[model samples]
Target: MIWPFNRKTSTETGAEYYIRDAAIADAKTLVDFKHRIWRDMFGHLKDEAFFTQAEATTDEQVKFWQSRISRGDTVWMAEDLRDRLVGTLHATTKHSEHTAEFVAAHALGELHELRYFYLTAATAETTIGTELIRTAIGDQPAITWLMGHAPLVETNLRQAGFEPLGEPIDPSDAPWKGIPRQAMVRQ
Candidate 1:
């Protein structure tokens, strides 16, 4: 569904942008955006072999996003006035089993995961990201979790009422292994 409060002006360009529910056609664009943002953020920290592996997963990413959108997860996209997809956000009740355990252990009721929330560098300073996150959260008082890597995202989440859940963990088993990531919760 299109969010009613999504319209905003970019601070950098003063161009209008809107956030709305993503469609199946957005899968490819989302994947491309994901690649761009991922590389921009982590490229210098990773090896060519890692990037090659990421390149090989394009189809998988497309399918994964498509399935999420089709399954009625809260997937929203921010588009410029020209209708170019510039950013995306996704939230869902579905999370890793370990995440569920974490929720239960903390007594966070029916938590939802902020699975993906990203903006292209050009649009990163706009209010669009905040609005998208608010749209996903709505009136739900339950806990929500987000893994924060970048300082901007962490600051935004904190400003939006999330707090660090615990110490940062080293993602030793994943790509960008050894990179410290913090788990945050909105409660």
Candidate 2:
């Protein structure tokens, strides 16, 4: 289901932006945006060699996002006045018993995982990201893995009513290995 929302750029400026369900055709753009945002936010934490070896190429990211979009994962995109994609949020229902167990432990029902939530630097100054997150998680209890370094994301989630729960889990084999990530939940 698509959750549509509209918000003005900033209180001082009245430019409007739209947030809607992502389409398969948006996969490439979404991937590119993700890459740019990721590098902008976390690149300084890693060396050039690590990025070269760990980051997925544009084609790989395109295929990954396309598959997720086609599979009907709850993905939302934020677009500017010109309809350029600037932000994205994706969520998936809990599928694994282990994840379900974690949700149960947190006293959250039928949990949905916040898979990817990001906004371009330009759009980050706006309320678009918060609205996208709020709409995406709508009446369902949700959980997310948050990097320790991403204070902005943590603050956003907390403002949306999510709280840190459990200990930080190590993403051993992922590109984010060695980065501390904590699980957060909102009921």
For each of the candidates, give the backbone clash count. Answer: 0, 0
Candidate RMSDs in order:
5.8, 6.2
- Candidate 1 residues 101-173, lDDT tens each? 7777778877667766777765667777667778887645434434423555656667677787876666667
Candidate 2 ranges with C-alpha deviation above 4 Å: 1-15, 54-56, 95-101, 104-107
Best by TM-score: 1
Which residue pairs collide in model 1, if any? none
Candidate 1 Cα misplacement greater than 4 A, ranges: 1-15, 139-149
Model 2 lDDT vs. the true structure? 0.73
> Candidate 2: TM-score?
0.78
Query: Which model scores highest in lDDT?
Result: 2
36-131: candidate 2 lDDT, tens digit per residue: 666766776666766666455778877888897788775898887768777778878854555676777766777788867876656646777678
Give all TM-scores, in the order shown: 0.81, 0.78
Enumerate residue pairs that collide in model 2. none
Q: Candidate 1, after superposition: displacement of residue 42 in Å?
A: 1.7
